[model samples]
Target: MSLLQDLFTRPRRNEQMGSSNENRSVLVVGLGRFGTAAARTLGELGEDVLAVDKDPMIIARWAGKVPVMEADLSDPLAVEQINASNFDAALVAIGDSVEASILTTGNLLDAGIPDVWAKSISHQHTRILQRIGASHVFRPETDGGKRVGHLLASRYLDYIEIEGPYSVVKVLTPPAVCGQTIAEADVHGRYGVSVIGVKNPGEEFQYGSNDIVMRHNGEIIILGSQKQIDKFIES
Candidate 1:
């Protein structure tokens, strides 16, 4: 049998479910790159996922892996048919067709799905999705570019942007702070950055403590605004 045919004959995850009302169940619409990635990660995280798409080939590929359904999510009736409201959250990952993306998002909202997250390709798309009641809108390409830009411009071993202007960064202990305890160096008072965690050369990460000494080659995780973090790193 062909791969698609073989997948079609296999038992689907949805069919094996004891109950669909389990906590953390998610409804994922659209089986594009973003959608598939989200579904797979959610599955690995132990969330029950029902992934829906209109393309039979996409459905075939995902069958028995996670819950897969073939349906036109742009159509409100189709969304209702699958009982999209049964899940705790829904993700609209349609990237190519703006019209379909908007329609699917609207359909989910109309179904009373409280948390509807959508992926937007442009500013206009984001605004429309928000106006139409999408709970959250993300631009993966734009966000990924900004994240990569931060990594490339600094000595940061890792960088993660938090809410507003704040960020969490991992970097080698600065020369100025080396060989001093957090309290002795007055890291917070002098640099305006909070050392939240630290990892020695061969040890696991540990919570930052005032008494913990900072070593020259050790790594520390700092939390502060971008400017403060940059200033601390430059010191």
Candidate 2:
């Protein structure tokens, strides 16, 4: 699968539950790392996407791969000219200039877009963006710290947050559970979690197997509430 597809792909349960929501168009301002990733994931999820950046080089890089435009997002007139009504949400991904990020976020809100997400470099910046009508503000550095903490605390190979208090976690089979089949393990009944899939060495995810005995250190993907996941890890 493509990078975007990989990023946006969800577990089967989530796919079924979320099927009712419409695929809304997204406008991502700035072609930086965060912006590009968001745009790619949005596109992979079948949403209409428009990516913008002021730099010509960045625009050239992602031109054919996705719909990209060049503009100084900080300029009110420049932002106002765009057909913002088409987009249901906007992401302010500008990393360097706080001024531009704030201005762009405000402009999007003023244009009648319902949701505006912004990236912030500091706590003060986050407060400023929130004051300017950004519906959501993220601090990448802070979130990165929390992610690393989760890895260390749970020893999970990978983790992704889902809606509410649920998470999907990938963990290697510990020595105690290595020889157990999914049925023998009784993961859901015992731990209040579901084993979504498993991955053996040199193999792709196999989601249909219940009798396959896990080998030592084989990886397993699971979906559960935070409390359930924590209990599973501790056991």
Candidate 3:
């Protein structure tokens, strides 16, 4: 879509989640892929997403999707303007430029925006963000690893652990009784699971080693929740 269309069409992140009982603004520092996606999610969810970036191109890309501006993200002064007590929640999704990202996060915290989520490029980056009072930190690439680990160890990448081992996950094929069709991996009967999708190598990506293209480094995405995933990982 055109830049104009991108601006008007892309929704921001979830504002409802960002605010308390009272409405509040959400600050999204950085307009990269993650920031853009988050901004869209919040905006579409009826939240106010105020995003910032140094590049006008980046700002223009998200023109109307969310309230965006072109400014040096690390500048505390610029951030102070957007991050008054008015911002209930905030996030930093800057990638590659570690120094600028950390500085921006520090500025956000100093501005007293209560809830903050910061993306990290490395453990050190996380440390600094933490020092600056980032409430939540995530390493997207590292998180993708946990997913890959679950998929590689089992035949499913379905559920996340809410509490403990008692997980809720879905399946595509059940566990094999005796190597039946791709659909025959009846994980349900064999392990009391649920099937969601099924695919073959040349067919489609339902959720199976046969269909999943393992990376050269031997990573795969399967289909199962944390409980069933344990079984896959053990083997």
Candidate 4:
């Protein structure tokens, strides 16, 4: 019923969707809500999550919940202790301070983290994070923007633009598209988009296009480069 309940209600196996390997350790560089969620999710799925932050209060809050540490995330020494190159992945969720976000990400990349999933404030920051070796970066703020854009752009019941030039978008299946296979939709040929995944809000997700109608709040994600996404949006 509540947002927390909804998040926890998502299928257990689906929670940790990306990064197939769970045996490896994951480092969450910021202990903000986003970082906390990432850390807890990793920990829940049998992966080791190392959460670090500069705030003593935040660090103390998650003390036993997961392996948490208080450290100056911007300091290279703090990053050096962890074998970034060896860690399965890392997530940076520092809010507001663009420099701290950039610097901390640089430290992790420089430390040689195998993969980094940093959080950014905007499209510009996302690009910067990538240039610095962030394997991936997420923007909760921009995600909200995409949702709004989709709702406003079309008569589609739900909408979500895949971040960046990835023309792919994850949207609630517009009734206009219900009961139709992707090929029938001609999304690529017409909409200039490709399906990435489909998740019915309260049901399982179909990765890529396939047979099956996921439930309401079900998400249909289309993929394409930025230009392609723009074309779809404008259409």
Q: Tell me, what's the RMSD of every candidate?
A: 5.8, 7.9, 9.3, 8.8
Q: Model 2 — TM-score against the truth?
A: 0.63
lDDT (Cα, tens digit) per residue for candidate 4, span 1-235: 7422333233332244775653666778888888888889988888766788899998889998888778876888876654455565678889868999999999988876667788888779989998888888788877777678766865444454544545345556665566667666666787667777777666676776645553444667766765665565444
Candidate 3 residue lDDT tens string, 1-235: 7432343333333333443454346778788898899988888887656787888888887786677878775887876554344567788899969998888888878876789899999999989888878999988888778667755765554544334445544433323332453234444445543433344344554544323322221223333455555564343
lDDT, model 2:
0.80
When sorted by TM-score, best at the front, the candidate numbers are: 1, 4, 2, 3
lDDT assessment of candidate 3: 0.63
Candidate 1 residue spans exceeding 4 A from truth: 1-23
Residue 24, candidate 4: alpha-carbon lDDT: 61
Model 2: ten consecutive residues of lowest lDDT: 6-15
TM-score of 4: 0.65
lDDT tens digits, residue span 66-117, model 2: 8788888687787765666446778999999988888889888887778889
Residue 133 Cα positional deviation in candidate 4, in Å, after optimal superposition = 2.2
Clashes of 2: 0
Q: Residue 209 in candidate 1 has what lDDT?
A: 92
Count of clashes, each model: 0, 0, 31, 13
| Per-prediction TM-score to the true structure, in the order listed | 0.83, 0.63, 0.61, 0.65
The candidate that wins on lDDT is 1
RMSD (CA, Å), candidate 1 to true, equals 5.8
